[model samples]
Target chain A: MKVKEIMTKDLTAAEPTMTVRELIELFYQSGLSSVPVVNEEGRIVGIISERDIIEGALPGYFEVLYGITDMNHLSQKLREIEHDRIEFYMTPEVIKIEEDEDDLTAADLMIRKNVKSLPVVNKDGILVGMLRRIDLLKDLL
Target chain B: MIITVTPNPAIDKIYWIEQLCLDAGELPVMRATRSYLTAGGKGINVSIFLARMGIENIAMGFIAGETGRAVERRVRDEGITTSFIWVEGETRTNVTLLERGHEQRPIQITEQGPTVPPDALKRLLIHYKRALNRARYVFLGGSLPPGVPTQFYQELTHIAHQHHVPVIVNAAGEALAHALLEKPWLVKPDTRQHTEIAGASLKTPREILAAGKEWTARGIEAVLVSHHITHDLLITCEGAWDLEARDVQFQNLLGAEDALIAGVLSATVQGASLLEAARFGMAAATASAESEELVVTDRTAIERVLPKIHIEQLL
Candidate 1:
């Protein structure tokens, strides 16, 4: 089977101008942990995951990892930057697979890259669909 | 470039249930065995069909919140250029429940979309005016969203005319009323909302023909109206045609009208005459009606039904 046949065509993406609060609502409504960020032409420019937002919300995330600050004090600061745009937090580098590729290739990329989801694109680099780890396991089970 | 505008766009959801429990007496739990979701609106549907036919077109309108984002994604996936202006509330989602035994009568519940503010319309006009420079044809379709004036399409028609671009309007009621004042190049009164056209109830074929003639006589270039699923009547400056498609297998009737318009646009862009293009449009509508998918993507499905369309000239 091709990736296009199995990929989730119910794509929910975000624009560069969308705020963190808006992205949170998108994740909540779509039941998705991550979404690809596209330009005006709908070409994939970056990808943002729930982890990125959660970690970005924590002002002390990096300090906590280095054992510098207590993790329990991470409150009230999230509200301060709710208006910050997702473009600043999103990883501009994205790993995307073509829709016409073999399904196994998509599975391999996800497993090897340790990504929970991958944005599916066509030959012109336009975001077409999204594939998650659970989607890859559907046919197997 | 062809620009299609859908003032009220939606994310259409269809759920196929084995047996839908419609009993109001008892608490019902309906589980869908299958489901499909896609971007929907007359103009958006035509954009998808046109994109599949390798006709480059831009999908434009006001979209809001997450549903709006999904609509854009779905349209982009179909290779359409998107120029949607984001507004304040969530875009509406229309649900269609298709029961196993009763596939003919699908239950649809639609929500009124976000009220587009006046400023949003201003922004859209500015963008639309810029887009008109490259536009070969502009299509204004669907109902007017809340907070929008009834004469919005008519005003847009005048703007398109100022640029020497022909405009096609597919609307009903007041929106259709105002559009006629400007004399759009082609008018297709949306009969789905109300079965009335040109201030007359469309109960009989003769009435629909009369309604088409009424608009065409007022200096409108053409008027096309659906008589039923398999039949339609088209009136143009040169003549009128009553078109019908035979051997149509009833599957899903959604998007058939838009498919017809898309077919006509796709063929007309390739230099086909209005009569022949309307024939192809009927064939496309028949093929779309015969398929389970909302929009038929394969060109051969339309080609297979082309010869079966019977077009009889009137007047």
Candidate 2:
């Protein structure tokens, strides 16, 4: 089977300019853990995940240790970066696969890179779909 | 038609229950008499209130995923037209737990919306420009989604200005600061949001007035600050006025600001003076607070509160 056979053809992509607020909303609405960052020309530029957002918004350990805790302080911290563009936090060096690639190759790349999903692109490097680790497992079964 | 933009819209899930406080690591059991979800976002709320007042408006913004679709559907169901840019990902869900026993204190958790890519943003802008062709006013509300520039509202204001459509911005902090540069027709920030931009504590009404004056001098046409429902201050290039509604039992103060904006817009579009608009806005806010709903729809309710609204000139 090729990558396109089992991949989620209807993929959701994000823009670099999307703010953390917008990303979280998308996450809540779509229930997707991560989303591919695509540019205006449909090129995959980066990838962002729920883990990235948590890590990006994480306060310094010193602040926590020093008892700098309160809804006010936390909300303030959020406001500081809530408007920040996604490019600031997304993994810019994206690992992607081509749509024509075989499922075995896609699975191999996922294992080698330790990534859960690979953005599947076309011959022109345009994002066409996404292949997840679960898809490969279902194929194995 | 008025166009309101909620760049990051949400499905506001309000849980109404009794007994909210709980012991550590223990869950407090309670039952909800009624629970409901509404399409929420500052811009969307403004549109709802505007529609309630028989004002036709379109709600425009980004909607993603299933939740986003639901928001669009619900808003459309409210008899308001929607022109949303369908982007990848989902719209956010804002949960508000209303504790009726605990003095009606509400705890809210908000989710950030999807990242709007450049292409999606371009589409939204194009949609907005087209909407502006028939727009009498533009209400840009709420915080922006990720990947959107901090100065995004400024661009919207610029576009509205180009079409001779005055804009009213209801935002906070950096977003409000950027919009100020574009000189929106009016900006209604809560006390905290206004003071954050003022870089000083506007503890007194006089101090808030001074801050509003400074903003007007910096090219902004008007600044309205709501001081915790006690009073609302409106300062414009024409003059300054302090608006207050006395002897009021507050019900739900959720969409008061949006209602206020709707009232002002409602008055302004009908060739009313800024002072008259401010008066009507104050009345509208009072009516909204007196209602269990997000915004007051009955003109009688607004009229009942109109006498209570006191607007005094300060400058």
Measured with C-alpha atoms, the lDDT of residue B104 in candidate 2 is: 31
For B1-315, candidate 1 gives per-residue lDDT tens digits of 798999999999999898876794588889998899999999999999998998878788888888988898789778786767667898999999988767668899998999988867875775577567668999999977898899899999999999999999999888888889999999888887778754777666788777777777888989888876678889987778889988777778887888899898888898998888898888888888887788786789898989889989887
lDDT (Cα atoms) of all candidates against the true structure: 0.83, 0.80
Residues A1-141, candidate 1, lDDT per residue (tens digit)?
Answer: 788767765435677777888777656644567888987556888989877876787744765586526444544555666799999889999999998998789989998999888899888787767777777898457
For model 1, report DockQ.
Answer: 0.05
Query: What RMSD, rounded to one decimal, does every model reach?
Result: 7.3, 15.0
Candidate number of the best lDDT: 1
Q: Give, for candidate 2 chain A, the lowest lDDT window spanning 10 residues.
A: A59-68
TM-score of each: 0.71, 0.67
Candidate number achieving the greatest TM-score relative to the actual structure: 1
lDDT of 2 at A28: 73
